[model samples]
Target: MENLSLGLMLMAVGMITVFSILLIVIYLSKLLIAIVNKVAPEEVAVKKATATASAPTVIDPNTMAAITGAVNIVTGGKGKVMKVEKI
Candidate 1:
């Protein structure tokens, strides 16, 4: 009976120690995240609300003709360029 009681006491103590350490780790991690976020905050890119972003760019008539001709030649006049996007 004494041996069984001693075994139970040791198991309880070991489990409590592990549980306490895990709780401490959780709180410390939360604290570290808060400190890091507050110190070096992320930079958000704030773009100006411009009419240019939504508008389509005008291409010179000759340049458009050349691009259209080249694309038609490459695809054997099968694929047509519906819209040209400039980066």
Candidate 2:
């Protein structure tokens, strides 16, 4: 019947449209990843240069001790503990 043929044609068109959209999305993601990778090295170099241009600063011993103490408390001093205890 003519109606059956029209239905088949519409189904084919819908499938084709879905496939086309999927391929477009995949292609765009690949393009964006490539662009980011290409530009990343230059961006990193700029950041490093800006960081190096800043004057070096000294840390206070008290602040360092407090930070280390907090980390040790959180970790339960596991890092300093001898695990094997080799005799």
Candidate 3:
């Protein structure tokens, strides 16, 4: 029937239109991201040296004991605390 053929044609046209629009939007978004990155690139973070960088940090007796106890409990007494340092 002519009506059936017309309906199919309309559906095909709508699908093609939506697909083309979606493709255009995707390409445009990629272009915008590339343009923005080129205009203002991300900066590399610089780490500043601490004043006590050369000196060794001393851990409190209580804090050290607590950390050691926690590690032992978590690892079922199989883990050993070789070094404890302050970040």
Candidate 4:
């Protein structure tokens, strides 16, 4: 019927329009992300905070005592830490 053909044509036009718009949006979003990454990129935090690998780490007596005390309490005085390292 003519009415059925007309309805099918309208539906095809609407679906094609929606798909075209969605494709444009996807490409635009990808382009924006690429622009942002090129202009101002995300920096790694680990590179900004680093210590000399050659120097030994030192802890103050008070900090060491507190850490040992906490460990002792947590372990019910059954374990002790031989060494400590800063990560």
The top-ranked prediction according to lDDT is 4
Q: What is the lDDT of residue 27 in candidate 2?
A: 100
Off by over 4 Å in 2: 41-87
Task: Report the Cα lDDT for candidate 4.
Answer: 0.83
| TM per candidate | 0.44, 0.44, 0.45, 0.45
- Please report how far candidate 2 places residue 80 from its true position, in Å: 18
What is candidate 4's lDDT per residue for 1-87, written digit by digit as tens? 999999999999999999999999999999998998788674533444333432477776798999999999999999889998877
Best by TM-score: 4
Candidate 2 lDDT over residue span 1-87, tens digit each: 999999999999999999999999999999988998797658788777756653353344585677677778989976442222212
Backbone clash pairs for candidate 3 read: none
Residue-level lDDT tens digits of model 3 in 2-87: 99999999999999999999999999999998887788654421212333442567676898999999999999999999998777
Better of 3 and 4 by TM-score: 4
Looking at candidate 2, the ten consecutive residues that score lowest on lDDT are 78-87
Candidates sorted by TM-score, descending order? 4, 3, 1, 2
Q: Would you list the C-alpha lDDT of every candidate in the order shown?
A: 0.80, 0.73, 0.83, 0.83
Residue 64 Cα positional deviation in candidate 2, in Å, after optimal superposition: 11
Where's the lowest-lDDT run of ten residues in candidate 3? 42-51
CA displacement after TM-score superposition, residue 15 of candidate 4 (Å):
1.3
Off by over 4 Å in 3: 42-87
TM-score of 2: 0.44
